[model samples]
Target chain A: MYAIDIKDIKKIYKGGVEALKGISLQVKKGDFYALLGPNGAGKSTLIGIISSLVNKTSGKISVFGYDLESQLEQAKAKIGLVPQEFNFNQFEPPLQILVNQAGYYGIKRQEALIRAEKYLKQLDLWGKRDQPSRELSGGMKRRLMIARALMHEPCLLILDEPTAGVDIEVRRTMWAFLTELNKQGVTIILTTHYLEEAEMLCRNIGIIDKGCLVENTSMKSLLARLETETFIFDVDPPTHLPSSEFFSIKQVDEVTLEIELDKNQSLNKVFAELSAQGVRVNSMRNKANRLEELFIGLVEKGSKNV
Target chain B: MFNHNYFIALKSIWRKEINRFLRIWVQTLVPPVITMSLYFVIFGNLIGARIGEMNGFDYMSFIVPGLIMMSVITNSYSNVASSFFSAKFQRNVEELLVAPVPNYVIILGYIGGGVTRGLMVGFMVTCVSLFFVDLQIFNIFVLILSVICTSILFSIGGLLNAIFAKTFDDISIIPTFVLTPLTYLGGVFYSINLLPDFWQAVSHFNPVFYMINAFRYGFLGIADVSLIWSFSVIIAFIVALYTLVAVLLSKGIGIRS
Candidate 1:
């Protein structure tokens, strides 16, 4: 069964700003889906609709085959949402907040307490369980939010910018935890500005721009669509400028030249051709394709066309 | 499947609200009692001696109920306004938005917190009033009903204020401008009978006047307005405010995207 199915979802705020327009997508069970977009690209809006945080103007959304509009409680029970903000009640201790969230799902206090303890321990928040949320550092608070969402053991977890304000160490730890959870049969949906993090964690990726979905596909296929390979050429002369017809020159400096090479065009061929032009190629490197470059290229290209 | 677990959701919000009030009991619970004691000392005893009796009772006994109502109103309004506004400030209300908790439960939970504080502070103020006079609760049922219902109505009003409040100053503005004036004019110190014809007619427009009179009638079997009129007005306000609050919450007026 599909973990989540959204069709023609639309949302317009009271100010008549349309945040999401006819957006649609699906996530298979156990799929780690990463949603990418620039600021105001409707990434969070889509997550809010599925999580029932924001009302959709028109459309349908179902979780684990339960219609969200008709069976919201069931749909919500199967999904957990970690919002972009550090929005937990700051005065309450971490443990109380977690248990209280479980209670909202109708879990008894005793059962919720047990689950809270387990998740807090799992999230490395057990020791800080008695501390008020405000006193916890930014990363700990984010982890607490993730732990709270997991108290009910939701099948689908929607994390919106979980690592946005988090430090490097905590980000890695959270990613590992979420990765392990996905391995244990939980489907994860995440929105992040860090494309590298998405590429590292998610198997499927969706790119949204200007309140619309521009692309959605497997990670491998998305990476494969980029025709350019980045090449940096270092030459002996500090003030030398090399003009080459074989590459699309991005930046030409005194000592180095950056160019984009098509996948079919070899970097070695360009280096050999430069040698024939009487330029000594000291060191050459083909920068691997990364999600950040691809995202920038796609979003910039999409926005210009719009 | 209709999830009947809204009570569960309410429980979470209620616990958080209760924890907030209780954690700062010195600030939330104690100040009102202290303030009311001073009111009884100055308005009820010292100044009451000069004013003398107007309604077949000592001046001190006449003002006790109004003072109690004042405590209830202020506590109820402040509890919800401050709590809800704090949630907004911290952006923590998003937790409820993402959960299965229906908007109504969120509304009720926050209101419940307000009512709890109002009643607690009112009860404490009542105990303090007894030390200064021979307090007598004439109509027990009406007194309890008026105080509780009025607390609920004002709590809902506070919720509306909190939703529209943009900042901490926004939270204080309503209680300062609207709530305080209406309350002081609500006949806390003097009966509407003392006011002239036009002022008495205008005093009738203050909702707090009806509530305080109804509450006062419960204590001394006397009221500025008819007892039945007072009861009906307070109940009507409760229903009207409850509906308005329900609609605003359902739309996520200020909390959602």
Candidate 2:
């Protein structure tokens, strides 16, 4: 089942700033979908629309087939949004805030308390339950937001920049927690500037740019589309760089050469050719598939033409 | 997945509202009671003795209802306005907007908090008035209804003010310029009947006048205007303000992209 189905979704703010331009995408049930985009690429705007915080000029959205406009209450009830900004009543304790969120879902006070405790503990925040939200560290605050979203047991969780400012360790912990949640059948939609986070966590990704979707595909397909492999060959200083027809090479530093080689191009052939030229190779390794490289290529290419 | 469980949202909002006001008792509760006591002492006891026997009731008794009404108005308006503005200021409002809770629940929850503060403060002020004058609840039912309704009306008004307010200065502008002026001229300290006929007709237009008069009628069973008119005006204001707020929230007027 599709967890979130957004079709022909368009959002035009006043003064005709088209923040979403008839975007369409589907998030499969239990899938961790990442929306990747640069600043001003409309990732937050799209999340805002799906969460019903931003009004759409026209679109059709459904959560588990409940129409967002017609069956708004139902559609909204199924989805939980964790915004990029930390937004909770600071004066309220973490547990109280979570319980209050449960109340919004019409959960009974007793049940809300139970659920709040359950999620807080799961998020490793139970220890700080009675502390006001303002007292928590930045990472803890983000975790509290996650706990609040989960209190209603929502089927679809949309996190906007969940780890934007978090330390690496905290982000890893959150990633682990979210992975466990996904394993238990919660569908996740996330937007982040961190391409590695998306590359690691999401099975499918969509790249939006200038209020339009520029690319959307499964992780494997997207990486595969980049057919060329990047290789950083560690070499002893050569008198001059090799002009090889087999590879595109650039001297990155005094001792290292960066080469872009297609799959059809063989490193062995380059090594044999290098041996023939008596160029001493110190070390060599194929670069891992990094989304940052791909993202830069895509966004830079797009920006150059416009 | 979209379930329209409005009651759940309502209970959540109401709980937050109650928690917010009750948590800050010194800020929300105590100051109003002290202010009302000062009013009772200076205006009711000290001044009422010099300006005695208006509308066939003791000066202290006549001003008691007005002071209570003033407290209710200020408390109700300030409660929602400040709370909502603070949420906006702190950016916490985004959480509610994204939650499953409907906009109406958000509106009602904040307003409920305001009404709680207003009525609670009003009740305390009424009790304080009792120490200075002989208490006579001439129309207890109307007094209760008037306070409750007026509290709701101004609470809604406060929410509207918060939506329009862009800064801290914006929040105070309404209460200072509009609300304070209306209350002072609302026949709170003096009777409209004692004014010239033209000014009495003008006072009829002040919504607070009806609220205070109706509340006073509840105490003394006497009013400068018809009690029914006072009740009707407060009810009308509630309906009008609720619609405006509902429309603004549904459109995401202040809280959206």
Candidate 3:
């Protein structure tokens, strides 16, 4: 059975805000899935519904074959959610928060203490575990929430924008920790505005837009759909531009050029062409983040369809 | 396994609430003790000295049980109201709602917290009163039962108020307008038999009157209301409030929306 299975979920909030419009999704067991969407695109609402924080207007949902309505305890036991906001008590210390959350899941006091210390040290929060959570820095609080969510060692962990405001270095560290956790066979569903983060960590991607599922596929397959990618080339001053008929090249002054090349087209042919014209390439990279480009394309297409 | 998880959930919530009040002892425990002491000094000593005997007992001892009940009701009501509403306002309630704990367990956990605070404050107030009056218990079981029943009733009332409250203002409105007025008119200060016939009839309608008089009956063997009637009203309110709270939680009313 899938880790998460949502069937025709519809959410019509109070006073007629249709946040989710008959959406269906499935995540296989042990898969690292990314649920991507722009703000107001219903990603958080969908997550809320899955976790039973928000009541749905209509739909069926299940986690690890446990129906949410009929088997709520089993379903809840299988999933852990780190919400977008800091919902923990600010007065409580990180250690207490984790221990309390573990207790909520039936872990005894001694086992909860052990799990709390384990996650606190693993998340680099053991040193400051005694201080009030409000005194912690923003990144520390975010990591604390993750540790608290993981206290029960749920089979499926859902994180909503876990690193939205984190600094680059801290975000990198979080990425490494999350990668290690995923490697240990935890199924994770992550929603993040950072497309590169999704591209790096998530194996499958589901893109939602305007209360509709726009795209859902493997990252490899999704990237494969991109017919053309723009690559920036840094060339020596002696290099001459290739024929405009064969390649779409946009000049970036004396020593640089940008070209939109088809995926089927070979970089070797372009190198041979450049060499024949006395142009030596120094460095080359994509003009835009590949996943970002696809994301924008998908969202724009979805908006147009709307 | 599920039942054990539910039990742990209740324990965790109960511990957290108790910790909260204890951590802020100055706000939760000390203020009530001070306030009740002032009542003892002003009402029991000076005023009672002028009035002398009331209902065949010294005025000081006569009002002691009523004053204790007053503190319990106030503390219990305020504890649950503020705590639950803050959870709603801060949205931390989602933590428990998303857990596998049943709604009844959630209500029971919070009620336990409120009852603890009420009982703690009541006990402290009772200790303070002993300095002003030589107290005697007419019946130990009746006294314990009255105080607990009254505390639980008010705590449940507070929870219901909190569930309906949308803002901080909404939480305080009922206490200030409805609760305080009803409490003061509940005969904590005077026996209803001393009042005029019409007002005495009206006093019988105030639910706090039953709680206070039943509690007073435990102390001085004198009551303005029947113990059976008082116990019945308090238990009925507790049952009705519990049912409502459970229903509200099940429907995902104000908190969920």
The CAPRI class of candidate 2 is: medium
Cα lDDT of model 2 by residue, B201-255, tens digit: 8998999999999998998898888887888899999999999999998878877
Better of 1 and 2 by TM-score: 2
* Fnat computed for model 2: 0.80
Arrange candidates by DockQ, descending. 3, 2, 1
Chain B TM, per prediction: 0.97, 0.96, 0.97
Question: For all the predictions, what are the DockQ values?
Answer: 0.59, 0.65, 0.75
Model 2 misses residue B60 by how many Å?
1.5
Model 1 chain A weakest lDDT span, ten residues long: A237-246
Can you list the residue pairs that collide in candidate 2?
A: A74-B2, A74-B3, A75-B2, A106-B8
Candidate 3, residues A1-306, lDDT tens digits: the string is: 999999999999989999999999999998999999999999999999999999999999999999999999889988889999999988888998888888888888899999999999998999999999999999998999899889889999999999989999999999999999889989999999999999999999999998999899999999989889889999888645566557787888898889888889888878887788788899999998899999999999988878
Which lDDT tens digits does candidate 1 get at residues A232-284?
87877633455677777644667777778887897677877777767777887
- For each candidate, what TM-score against the reference? 0.91, 0.94, 0.95
Off by over 4 Å in 2: A233-245, A267-289, A304-306, B1-4
Model 3: CA > 4 A from native: A233-243, A251-257, A268-283
